[model samples]
Target chain A: MWQLFTQNWQDFLTGFWHTILSSIIALVFSFILGSGFAILETNPNKFWRGVAKVYVEIFRNIPLLVVTMFFYLVLPKVLPAMNGFTAGTIGLTLYTSAFIAETVRSGLQSVGTGQMEGCLANGLSYWQAMKNVILPQALKITIPPLGNQFINLIKNSSVLAFVAGMDLMYQGDVIASNTFQTIPTYIIVGIFYLILTLPLSYYMQYLEKKLA
Target chain B: MAIIDFKHVDKFYGGFHVLKDINFRVNGGEVVVIVGPSGSGKSTLIRTINGLERINDGSLIVDGKDMTDKSTNFNELRRDVGMVFQHFNLYANKTVLENIMLAPRIVLHRPEEENHKEAMRLLEEVNLVEKANSYPHQLSGGQQQRIAIARSLAMKPKVILFDEPTSALDPEMIQDVLDVMKLVAQEGITMVVVTHEMGFAREVGTRVVFLADGEILEDSDPKSFFDHPQTKRARQFLSKVISH
Candidate 1:
């Protein structure tokens, strides 16, 4: 493991940086998309609600790799061509967003009906009440679950490896094959994953305590 | 003119009739108290004034607009009406000052300086000025209710509805809330309150409406409603309530 890393240190660092960049992009986009869909799912308008439901159901039921392949292979044929990194990030964003939507919708429901009623009775328009009063409380309830989704998103970014997106896992596979040190290369990869996930997990626990 | 008027209002929850053929009017500056046993539609009735509860059949006029009309915007109408819930439905995420300042700033679009000044005044009115930065969960029940009152008052509503405002408080805490309510009543703001506190009703109510089986069984001055209680149900209700 030490020899592999020292010899291919540049390749490993490049892969790690790529993984970090892709994960950050996916995380931001997925949160915004997920929250938008969650609002639509809980909206009073039937059409918007149905649209959100279909998006969540379709993406959530499909495997992440299958979705990535569709974007990588199918999208280029119908539209403009795209690289593996872009395709994988889009796939990861959509897949993780579906689960996040459901988590956020449940959080929205957990807020008491009285909160919305109190806001409306105080003369807030529906959107105003939702943005100012309901969403804050709902987001508070969603933090723990949202943290889980983010951690899963980071792990799921590994799916980029199958598509040749040059992420940490792809680098691990390349280094293992080139160096023939399979166990240590994989162990190093796992340590990197833990480095990403453990801090998030602890932060989420701390946030839950602070909010409580 | 009546600030709130309900004419032949009917409300149903699925197959169950919640408010039946209700007809009443609340004029400007009058404090109307509604008293009834559990499930007698008192809360439902007051909620209709602000469009919180939609009436299945009837016309509800609030501040000269017909709430039952589809064209009437309830949000615009609600700007003139405020409600304080039994649970003190203060925005749990907001500080006491923020709770009072939110609607005025957002809905009414009041200037920030004026909004702050008025919010502080309302807080002072409710005697919770010291708890300005405190969250709802940090306060006692009576104190929370007082903050709720200040929040409602922040809107400068023409009418305020209190739905069992003091019922959720401890016996020792009830008087503090009632005292705040009494001061509000003395300010001559139009109020419709649903409560079991007959003492507050007799002391502050100009009119009392007794509800039972979803019907307005008695509507008279508090003195007559309490002392005379013409209907047998009214007599029984007053007897049971007063004996306790």
Candidate 2:
């Protein structure tokens, strides 16, 4: 294990950094997209609700590898050519957003219907009622589920490995192949993932407690 | 002029009729109390005034604007008519003060300083000035309902609807909410209250409306309605309610 570290520290560091960057970027974008779609799903208008439903169903049903591969192998043929990292991040964002949307929609529903009626009766427009009264309560209910979706998103960023996106898992595969030390190399990669995820899990628990 | 007028109104919940051929009018400064047994459609009748429940047939007018017209913006009409729910639906995320300040600031576009001042005044009216910064859950049921009342008052509405406001309160807490409501009534704000509290109906209401099976059986001054109820149902309901 020490030998693997000494031999390929630079590669491991670069992979770790890339993984962190991609996850952060995907996390932010997916949150925005997921929240938007969740709001759309909860909207009274049939058209917007249908659009959100279709988006969530399509992305959530497909496998993560398949989604990543489409962007990596299929998208470039239709649009401008994109690199592996960008493709993987986009795929990760879209895939995770579906789960997030579902979690958030449940949260919105958990808030009593009276909350919306109260705001409307107080002269708020529908959107205004949603933004001011409904969403705040919904967010509180969604935080625990949202945290799980985010943690899953970070782990799922490993899909980049299949496309040679140079993330931590990709580097682990490369190192294992070249050094023939598969078990140790993978162990190191697992440790790095724990390093990223454990704090997030603990933080989410803390947040849930504080909010409760 | 009447602040709210319902002419031959009918409302149906699918196959079940909720309100039937209701002809009701709330004149300015009149406190109208509606009393009925459970499932008698008292709530449905009051909710229609602010467009919370849409009437299936007939014309409904609020503040002189025809609520049945599709072009009439319900949000604008709601600005002049506020409602307090039986559940005391204060915003769970907001402080008591923010609950009062939100609609006025966002919907009315009241200047912040003016809005804040009015919110404080309203809070004082409800006797919750000390709890302005507290969240809804932190307050007791009576306090929460009072804050809800203050929130409705912040809009300075022409009419306020109270839908069984005291029904959810503790027996001990009921008086606090009723006191605030009584003050609101005395100030001449047109009020439509649906309640089981016979004392409030007789003392605070200018007129009492007796409803049964989706129709108004009696609409008369509180004295006549209580002392000389015309209908058998009204007499029976009054005896049962007043005895408790």
Candidate 3:
């Protein structure tokens, strides 16, 4: 195992880059989508809130692999032009967004009702209060949970491999199948995930401490 | 002329009537203290003036605007009728000075420097000038309540509401907050305070209102209300609290 790693270090490093890039893109896109849905859930209107609730439940309850597979295999048939990588990335974003929305919506709820009432009493419009006071505070409360969602998102990106999406796990699988170095290839892939997840954990811990 | 008029107002919380046939008038520069047993609707009545609690039936006129109407701009009314909560609600994330200056700078659109100066002056008035830079967590309950009063005063509001301001404070800290309130009453800002501090009520309140079971049992001058208690409910309540 040690000898194989020494020989294929370059290949593993290249695969590591692919994983990190995919995680970054998914993280950014998911956060944007998740925050939008969270705002929808916070809306006072019953119709919009129900719509947001339906979106969250549908995405979060279904298996991530199933969603990715549907996007990769079925989406191309429906759209006629969508490829595996695009479909997988899009699916990862939409799937992760559901959990992230739930996380952020709970965060927004945690910052006591008085904060909003105080802001409203101070003459801020509801949107202004949300933008300036409520969201800033909510962001602080949601960071740790959001960080957990992001790390899980990075690991979940491995589902792209089932669709031949060329993420780190996909490349590792191809390398192992060709070389028959199953354990070593997987060990390398696991290390790449650790490399991505560890830094992310530390970054979120830093944010939690800074905000505290 | 009365700046706030509650004409036969009725408020219900889903069939549990919290305020019934509440008729009252508060003229500009008058200080009214509302005293009652817990859940007697004194807080609800005061909250209705600023539209924090809506009246189910009848007219609530403040500053010549009908508050009972759905179109009435409660936020605008709140700007002129500032409120201090029992819990202080001092914007926990903000510093003492920020708590005071935020409303004037944001709501009134005052210049930053002018807002800061006025806030500092109010802090000095409350005897909390030294604690202006400290966060709410850093201050004692009395200090936080004083800052809350200063926050409301910074808007230069025509009227102010104190909802059980000292009820949440330590016994020793209550005096400090009451002193600031006494000064505010002297300054002639129309004040409606819900409190059990009978001494402060007698000292500062020109008029006193006694409420029981969501109705105004008595409303009269402090001397008459205290010395010649009219209702059996008022007599019972005063004996229960004031004797202690």
Candidate 4:
């Protein structure tokens, strides 16, 4: 098992790099999209609120694989086909954003209306009130949930492996098949994931305690 | 000239009428106290001045601008109108000084040094200079309300509205909040206060507007409205409120 890791180190490294890239890209875009939808969910306009509600329900309820498969298999019919990495990242981003939207929306709603009223009455515009006053307070309440969603996104990025996206799990599959070291290769993949998520999980726990 | 005018205004929440044909005007520099029983629309009436609540029918003018007009920028009007809620509603994430400085910095675009200087002055005005660096959660209810007052004053708003400002405070804390309010009244800023504090009303209020069941039962000087209320609703309200 040790020799297998040493020999297949380059493949593992490639997978790790791809996984990191996908997670980072998905994390950034999902946060922006989720936060945007969250704001729209809280918007006073009924139509926009409806749109947000539909988007959140659709993406959140759908299976992650189905969403990724749609992009990989279905999207090619209409638009130029994207590579597996692109399709996987987009699906993960959209799927994770639904949960993030729910998390952020709850946080936004939890902030007492008084805070927004106070900011508005103090001459701040709606956007200014949200940006400067409401979002900051909401963010404090959302940190723990958002942290969980981020970790989930990193784990879910493994969905990329199913589509030949060359993530850590994909490389593990390649090595296990070639070398027949299935158990050890899978163990190493699990360990690699722990390296990324464990510290984050601990950091979020610490934050929750501090805020509490 | 009237700074806030409500001309036959009507407001409803679904089928429930909240403010019925409200016809009243608040002139510049006058302190108007609006007192009523619960659901009497005291808060709603004052809120309409800043476009916080929309009037279903009729014209409303504030600070030489017609609020009911769709083209009117409510945010610009808000710069001239400030409000202190029953709850302090200070930004929990911001320090006390930041609470005061945020608007002038972001909204009014006041330079940092000038804004900081003004914030310290307002903190002095609220007698909370020492607590400038403290967060809202760190302050007592009275202190937080005082800082909220300082935050509104930072905008130099032409009119300030208080919606049952002390109703949410502890009995002991109420007096401190009222004292700061008195200081604000002394500055000759136009104020519309919805308070149950009769003593503050009798003392600082130039005019008293009595509301009951969404109607202006009486609008008179504080002395007559207190001593010789015009309508039976006003009389009954005063009796019920004063006895308790």
Candidate 5:
């Protein structure tokens, strides 16, 4: 493993950076999409509520690999062909968003009804009450569960490897097959994944403590 | 001139009737105290005034706007009406000063300096000047309730609703909240308070409305209602709550 690390360090670094980029992009887009859908799920309008329900169920029930494959294989037929990284990241964003939506929606519901009523009776529009008063309070309750989603998102980004996305896992597979050092190559890949995830998990704990 | 007029109003929660054939008028500067037993719909009745609880039947006019009309903007109407809840629902995320200033600034678009001055003045008025930067969870129940009242007053609402404001307080803290309410009453903001404090009803209320089983049982001057409760139900209610 030591000899392999020294020989292929540049290749390993490229894959590690790609994995981090994919996770960050997916993490950001999923958060926005998830929060928006969660708000829609709670909307008073029936049409919007139905749309949110359908979208969440579709992505949440399907496997992440299948979702990513569909984007990689099928999406290119209709839209312009996207490389493995783009397809995997887009798929990861939509899939992770479903779980995040549920987390945020439950958080929103947990906030006492009186918060909305107080703002309403105090003379604010419904959206104003939601934006200024209710959402901020819900965000505190959402931090822990939302943190879990983010950690899961980084791990799931490894699906990019199956589609030849040149992420950490893909590099591990290539090096193991070529050098026939499967054990050491995969071990290095696992360590790189830990590098991405452990910091996030600890940062979430810090945020939870500070908010509390 | 009537500030709130409920004409033949009927509200039902599916099969259960909440407000039944309610016809009443709250005139300008009149503090109407609604006293009732649990599940008798005093909260439901007061909620209808601000369109928080919609009526299933009849025209409910508040400040000349008929709530029954589909186009009547409740949000716009709420700018002139305010409410204090039993739980004292101060925005948990904001400081005490932000709790009082937010609605006036966002909804009314009050200038920033004027909004800050008004919020601080209202905090001083509520005797919570020292708690301006503290969050809602930091305050005692009575103190939170006083801040809620101040938050309502900051809107300069023409009418205010009190839905059991003192009921949630510690016995020792109830007097402080009642004192703040009495001060509000003195300012002649039309108020409809649902409370069991007979002493407050007698001293601060211009009229007493007795309700039972979602119907108005008695409406009279505080003296007549307390001294000579016309209905047997009102007499029984007064006996149960007013021990002193």
Candidate 6:
């Protein structure tokens, strides 16, 4: 295992780039979709809120692989030329967005009732209150849970390999197949994931402290 | 013309009948103190002025705007009618100073320099200038309540409402908050307060209104309210609270 990492150092370094790319893409898209869904879930109109609820349930209940496979295999048939990477990235975004919606919804709810009343009493409109006063406080309350979701999201990105996506895990499978060094190649992959997650975890901890 | 009026108001929380046929008038710069037992709708009555609580049936006119009208702009009414809650509902995310500055900046659209200066002055009035940068959690109940008062005053409203402002404070801290409010009353800003503090009522209030079981039991001057004892409920309540 030790020798494998030493020998495959260059390949391991290259894999880091692929892992980072998938994570960055997933993070940006998921946050956008997730925040949108969270707002929809909390909408005063029952119909819009119900629509958000259905979207969350549908995406969250299905396995990420199944969703990715459907996209990778089925979407191309429906609309020509959609590749594995596109399918996997889109799948990861949708799946992670469901969880992110849950996180943010709870965050918004955790803000006390008085905060809203206080804002209203001070003559701020509802949207103004939510955006300026409530969200800042809710975002603070949500950091630890949000950080956990982000780490889980990075690990979940490995599922991209099963769909023949050219992610870090796919590269690891190729290296192991060619070299017959399964344990070492996987061990290298595990270390690559550790390298990615540790710094992310630390950064989140730093934010928690700073916000505290 | 009366600055605030609640005429034949009846409020019901699902047949509970919270405030029955409430009639009161507060002229410009008159300080009215409402004293009552728990669940007597004193808070509800004041909240209706800013449309925080809808009266089931009544005409609530404040600064000439009829609150009963569905077309009335509640947010606009609230801009000119500020309320300090019993819980000292200062925005927890904001510092004491931000709590004071926010309304003036957003609602009034005042310049930043003027807002800051006014907030500083209000904080000084509340004796919270030293704690301006602190969060609400960092302050005691009395300090938080005082900050809440300053936040309401920042709007420069036509009238201010207090719903048991000092009810949640400690015994030692209650007098300080009342002192700030007494000063505010002295400044002749139209004020309506719901409180059990009969002493403060006697000292600062121009009129004293007693409520029981969601109905006005008595509405009179504080001197007559305490000395004369007009109603069975008001007399019993005053004796109970004052003896304690």
Task: List model 4 lDDT by residue over B1-244, tens digit each.
Answer: 8888889999999999999989999998899999999989998898888888988999988999988788999899899899998888898889999999999999899999999999999988889999999989888888999999999999998899998999888899989899999999999999999999999999999999999889998999999999999898889989998898
Off by over 4 Å in 6: A1-15, A39-48, A75-81, A205-212, B68-70
Question: Which scores greater on TM-score, model 1 or model 4?
Answer: 4
DockQ of 5: 0.87
Instruction: State the local distance difference test value for candidate 2.
Output: 0.93
lDDT digits (tens) for residues A1-212 of candidate 5:
89999999988998999899999999999999999999999888999999999999999999999999999999889988989999999999999999999999999999989999999999998899889988888878999999999999999999999899989988888888999999999999999999888998999999989887
Candidate 2: CAPRI quality band: high
**For residues B1-244, what per-residue lDDT tens digits would candidate 6 score against the true structure?**
9999889999899979998999989999999999889988889888888888898887888888988888998889888888999898888888899999987898789999999999999999998899999999999999999999899888888799999998888999999999999888887789999998888999999999999999888999999999997888888998899997
How do all the candidates rank in terms of DockQ, highest first? Answer: 5, 4, 2, 1, 6, 3
What residue runs in model 1 are displaced by over 4 Å at the alpha carbon? none
Quote model 1's TM-score.
0.96
Look at candidate 4 and tell me the lDDT of residue B161: 94
What's the CA RMSD of model 2 in angstroms? 1.5
Candidate 2 docks with a DockQ of 0.83
Model 5: per-residue lDDT, tens digit, B1-244? Answer: 7999999999999999988999999999999999989999999999999999889998899999999998999999999999999999999999999999999899899999999999999888889999999999999999999999999999999999999999998999999999999999899899999998889999999999999999999999999999999999988888899876
By DockQ thresholds, what CAPRI class is model 5?
A: high
B99 Cα displacement, candidate 1 (Å) = 0.8
Global lDDT of model 5: 0.94
Worst lDDT run of 10 residues, candidate 6 chain B, spans: B55-64
Top candidate by DockQ:
5
lDDT of 2 by residue, A99-207 (tens): 9999989999999998999999999999999898898889898998899988898899999998989999999999999999999999999999999999999999999
Q: Write the per-residue lDDT of candidate 1 for residues A1-212, one digit (tens) a residue.
A: 68777898887777788788889999999999999999999998999999999999999999999999999999999899888889999999999999999999999998888888889989999899889988999999999999999999999999999888989999989988988899998988888888999999999999989988
Which has the better lDDT: candidate 1, or candidate 3? Answer: 1
In candidate 6, the residue pairs with backbone N, CA or C atoms under 3 Å apart (3 or more residues apart, or in different chains) clash, namely: none
Query: What DockQ does each prediction reach against the true complex?
Result: 0.82, 0.83, 0.51, 0.84, 0.87, 0.72
Interface RMSD of 4: 0.7
Worst 10 residues of 2 chain B by lDDT: B235-244
